[model samples]
Target: MLQLKLYYHAKPYLPWRFRMATRRFFAKRKRIRYSGSWPIDPPSGAVPDDWRGWPNGADFAFVLSHDVETQIGYNKLDELLEVEKQLGFRSVINFIPEGEYSVSERRIQELIERGFEVGVHGLYHDGKLYNNRATFESRAKRINRYLKQWGATGFRSPLMHHRLDWLHSLDIAYDSSTFDTDPFEPQPDGLGTIFPLWVERKIANPESLTANQENQISDRRSAISGGKSKKPNGYVELPYTLPQDSTLFLLLRESSNAIWKEKTAWIARQGGMVFLNTHPDYMDFKGNGNASSFPISYYADFLQHVKESYGGQYWHATPDRVASYFVGCGDR
Candidate 1:
């Protein structure tokens, strides 16, 4: 913890090149160490117990989301939107409320008006939200305020750090801070399932909530089918099932989207959700290698592949609608 504190404290002073190189070194080691589990965790594909299956009998659910952490990323939203639009896809755009960049309500509304859902990323992109109970409680108030102000119903933590029980404080329909499997993250632990789980506010025992996700899911699932008690409400937890864009394009330096395509196919076969979280900050429309950005074509190609390979077989949805459907199904 001390090491992480020092690293984040000094992060502002370190050049991104130095940090990326340092991470790349460690990431490569982790990639080899966890090669069998990451990107494609076989057990994660298991359908949830008593699953009702996707809407309209679709093979799988698909959702795309982006986190804009800087002014540069915010500026590229339009270009990114156009690419997705051209491919007949829509996604959720999550903005940092108090990060290095400033986004106006008008801009957020513009995204909503353009057929995109808006969400609140962490208050700051810094990795401090879960530093301690007090810090999280304090920030939750502010985060909830932003969620209300922006009329957003989703929240994703920065760096994928999460405290599932702590998240119940926020006024949101769903939280996308967890992933199915990613050893590259600051919090290397994963939820171990591709399906979204309901984090019932009253049922989540403090002890289970702090444990690893497998145990957490076990305790929650037993409590799910029962009618929602007069117990306090809870929010849906959508664990992104695909590899993050930065982990693939920047840290691992992958040359193509083959990994994405391969994983998507597997998820489809298992009838699980193909939830993806990408960053516009690292998408290079210019095709220049600046800041280790990858060509936007990599993303566009993946979208095109989805369109061609699985046309009419998947339920393409925004994050909010996914959560709404899950809630309305009374499976919570």
Candidate 2:
């Protein structure tokens, strides 16, 4: 069936009650297989005991990324940057080149200047980028142009509306548009692994890609061409791990960082990637409320938990650095 990409952003503007009612409707269906909620080793299995930690002997890995969707969010970047910097953390900030926010070269440079990573969020972020083949083909060219202009090698589809086969055409190195366990996204399909994956001609199926669990992630990285040669043209895909604020703190109207803490531990135990996408637009400065209504210091607390629990055990790096680490392993 053709996926009718209704205005994807319309849900956020929905009446509060309607949003809650809809959440009630799909809550159970979304968890049928525990797709986005469960880690690589669900009840049916266990993480391979031979699992190795991240490079540098770090216990696990975490990558923080943000998608700038609105002007308020763009303006909120300074505050977020201050928080991350003050805490000794660096994150990749993705910007929409076109759409409600007009990202200028100056804004791009600001991110670059601050020692942060810059990534390309979809050109328009309108949810229609992949309504069909021709539409994506048309937009893909502009997206590539923006990639070069903005000097971005990472991409996260607007609202996470991704068509992997079509997305492969872009010359980016990695994409964080997929998830390991997320039920609230516009397109909620979990690729079933918590590590970076090679999305290319060789990787034709998700299960086959991860079914060989032993050395699964390392094996996949070895096959990535990263656009260096025509023999196997493809990109690495880093699955976003934690639930977005819109889904957890807003639509579901939860009030705590319990989920973040839980998932962080699971990813660590599995010794997998902990890539997260928390939008600045959805944050709540106040520390109390429906939580879904606001971030309310939830993000900060989550970071603190990571530092306290794992401390030097986890490799806290951006997605680009992780990608490089994987590629570097392959080169060795």
Following a full C-alpha superposition, what root-mean-square deviation does model 2 have from the true structure?
6.8
RMSD of each: 5.7, 6.8
Looking at candidate 1, the ten consecutive residues that score lowest on lDDT are 222-231
Judged by TM-score, which candidate is best? 1
lDDT, candidate 1, 57-135, per-residue tens:
9999999999998888988989999999998899999989998888888988888898999999988888888888899
Model 2 quality (TM-score): 0.82
lDDT score at residue 220, model 2, on the 0-100 scale: 31
Per model, how many backbone clashes are there?
A: 0, 6
Residue-wise C-alpha lDDT for candidate 2, range 1-332, written one tens digit per residue: 14434445465577867756877578656655565345333531234343444788876788899999888788788888788887788899998888687888888887888879899998886678887788888888898899878877788998787788877657576888898766566676777777777666445454554434424333333434343322233567888877777777666556787878887787777677787788887675544454335863788888777777787888888777777666544422
- Per-model TM values vs. the true structure: 0.90, 0.82
